[model samples]
Target: MTTQTPAVRLRGITKSFGSNLVVEPLDLEIGRNEFFSILGPSGCGKTTLMRMITGFETPTGGSVELDGKTVDRVSTRERDLNMLFQSYALFPHLSVYENVAFELRVRKTAKAELDTRVREALALVRMEEFAARKPAELSGGQRQRVALARAVVGRPAVVLLDEPLGALDQKLRKEMQFELKRLQREVGITFIYVTHDQEEALTMSDRIAVMSRGRVLQVASPIEIYDAPTSRFVAGFIGSCNLIDAVVESGRVVVPGLGAVPATLPDGTADGARVVVAVRPERMTLSDQPIEGGFAGVIAERVFLGDEWTYHVKAGETELTVRVPSGETSTALAGLPEGGRVWAAWPAAAGRVLPADETASPLIGSPA
Candidate 1:
């Protein structure tokens, strides 16, 4: 039996600028036709990693493989990959059609085939109507579409996008997120996207690699990354989470001041060892009346988001944030004002015990 080769593979890849190590030795594989995203804060080495894959940045150690072949010596132009930059690096003088056809023109493709490919790419991005327009004349979103068209015009085996929608407004960015996903599905090409936006990564990627500093922290699907983060940093970085310092005793994590919160201990977690328990805000439920097995608290503040209500509850010394979906059931809490006493409770499985010394800090911050 033979194993199929991955679309792209990184083995012991590392990069350094003098003594400053940027990307640590790392290994990863991106399957064919996968929408893979490398997510991290600024200076987390996500972009550096993508550049290495594109052959724009040479690695200080190890090798990069494309379809099972080592490409350490391959020049950037020879790599069958296209990159869409965050700046949307479109040509100012060229028309949209020309910009999309740039790669084909470089290859000296016959005019009939070049026209067919360019038109198809533009149509896929819904920018065929703007073919005659120049980049300066288009809006940010439209220009982004043109960039997308250009990137996929040649139908490369892999496409690299580095924060391509960072310049758009929130609404437009959300719209383009869906558009990008749809385009990827239609083309069925392996996409390696690099972005610091957690939400964007979660929304678009089939799987995400969360990185910090120069190392990959975790790689999983959106739900797995959010629901079962391997570290405190990942739990807090991927979404809003409540991390309460605790100690494991008799298979349960005992939180200070709040008493023992039922939790499942991670394997190899010795009894009486210090740990951090992570719980998503949405996993907690709030009740005005005291309930069995629930911790008592006073509502410190409440914010009415359109789809949900976020409440900060003072549970003993810990301030726990609870998210309640807005609707009839949740509206019952509307009468409760600040200082109103309530009970906060969650299922035992909701809390995940994390290693205390897994990283230097629990907070995820962009590297300097």
Candidate 2:
């Protein structure tokens, strides 16, 4: 049997507009039928990367491969892929059925096959009933579904979505997140989704490539990316983290006021080297009693987030945040008001020690 090739591959791909280098040289592979996401804030070059893939923006270096063949010289229309933009880009003069059929029509597919594929695509998106309606006559969500149907109607090798749900309301966007994943699975096509929304990437992607300042920082499964972020930028950008200044002492990092907390150290880190102890707010526990290897502090503030309570505890110059789910246990442990003394504790494995110099240096922009 022959080996199966990856759906998409980028080898040392780099791009720039004049003197501005938007996309750094990078390599990545997206598997067939995989829901892959390129996640980053604005100006991180995720859009430029997608454009390079779709042939809209040529790379200054390296090559793009689709289904085991180089496509550097291929035109966007001849790349055997489709793109879905945030605007939906459906034709106002045509009905949903016609928009879905447009690709097959352009290819001059047989009438029977085009009709069959168009209906199947519409049905896959649950838009078969609205096939006769124009873009202006449909809701934002419906139009998005129509756009998705158009993108997948021709059974392309891959479909690139550049924030397709950016136009919808928060509620609708959340709803479409699942819809896009479902449709992707049903169609059995590679989906290259680019978005700055961390939750969206974590919610829908099988694997995620997190980018910053035109560079790919880390790529892994959503859980792995969140739990084992390689750098400070990744740890802080993926979620809310308590990044505390500390100094390494063998197996533990000692915070000035909090004492020594056991943490995992990076390779080659010296005992006296400065480092940052990164911990998630939700991973920490608060108690009125002093905890071993923990910090004793007073609750400075508490934020109520419906289902969870976030407590800001002040211990000397170092402040730590702890998130506790709203429940009887939370009230008992984290219900303390301001000035109430408590101990903030976490398991040894929860603390990740990163180099001080790279702790939070790379700046991240606003979410796309």
Candidate 3:
């Protein structure tokens, strides 16, 4: 197989401001025509990394490369990159056509060529019919489309989106997610997106990099990141997971009041070593029948979440959240009182063992 050069590469990148390190030394490679997302909570340095790539912030150490060329010394305007901001940043006085043509005009392109590119860009974003409308007269979604048109009008090799859909409501944001993914595939350009929304990242990214405390914890596809996370932080941050403290003994994880659950430990894991067992709530099954190899618990609460039912089950001193899909057969359990007794069971392979050291430091930017 042939290896393609990365569209963007960061080598030992580091950023600091007066002894406060916002971005630690890190290396990353983004493939060409890839929709990659940098995901984390606020103040986790995702935005800072985007700024460094866009030449808005200079790294204290290391370099930034694009298409195999070092771009650390290149001015932001000289680099072939475009950025879409959360606020849209459109010109209130200009019409959509003029806004989309702004970049081409600044580059001294001929008027005829500028008009052609502007119309094409607008059409690409499905906003060509609104070309005559000003930014002030358009809705939030329309303004976003105009901003997208302007970013791609110059046909840059890379587009940096820093929470581009943040301003829209939930319904509009969901609609734009599909639009953005389709646009990325059609343009065939590298997209580096930064956002704190986990579901959004999983929905749009070809691959995701989970960052914390200015450091990347893991980089993988959505399924791999969720199903087999590398650390406690990644497991807990990416989705709702039950992280039970356990000890490794006889090749199994021993959970307090839960007995030993079959698990695959990492290579070189020693007997009697402490580890954490991660299990997704949906992977568990709840039943009223007494079953072998199951933990007995009482349903403390139940919540109806449209498509699924969430039950807070208390076993011994630990509380576990279990999710049961909504269906004719499962709906029978809906009437089960909160104090009803139930058993929760899951496949032996559902549990994943992670290094216990991951919990040593509090998550960066977490509330005190």
Best by lDDT: 1
**What does candidate 1's lDDT look like per residue over 1-368, in tens digits?**
97879999999999999999999899999999999999999998998999899998999998999989999999988998899988999999999999999999999999999999999999999998999999999999999999999999998999999999989999999999999999999999999999999999999999999999898988889988888788878888988999989987786779989888967665655788788888999988888877788999999999989888899999989989999888833444778999988899988889877767654432222111
Model 1 residue 270 distance off true place after TM-score fit, in angstroms: 0.3
Q: Give the TM-score of candidate 1.
A: 0.95
Model 3 residue pairs with clashes:
none
Over 4 Å off, model 1:
328-332, 358-368
lDDT of 2 by residue, 218-324 (tens): 88999988887777788888989988889877756788876788676655566787878789988998888888877788888988888988889898899899998
- In TM-score terms, candidate 2 sits at 0.94
Question: On a 0 to 100 scale, what is the lDDT of residue 276 in model 1?
Answer: 86
Show pairs that collide, candidate 1: none
| Cα lDDT over the full model 2 | 0.87
Candidate lDDT scores, in order, read 0.89, 0.87, 0.87
Using TM-score as the yardstick, the better of models 2 and 3 is: 3
**For each predicted model, how many residue pairs clash, with residues at least 3 apart or on different chains?**
0, 0, 0
Question: Residue 10 in candidate 2 has what lDDT?
Answer: 97
Q: What is the lDDT ranking, best to worst? A: 1, 3, 2
Q: Estimate the TM-score of every prediction.
A: 0.95, 0.94, 0.95
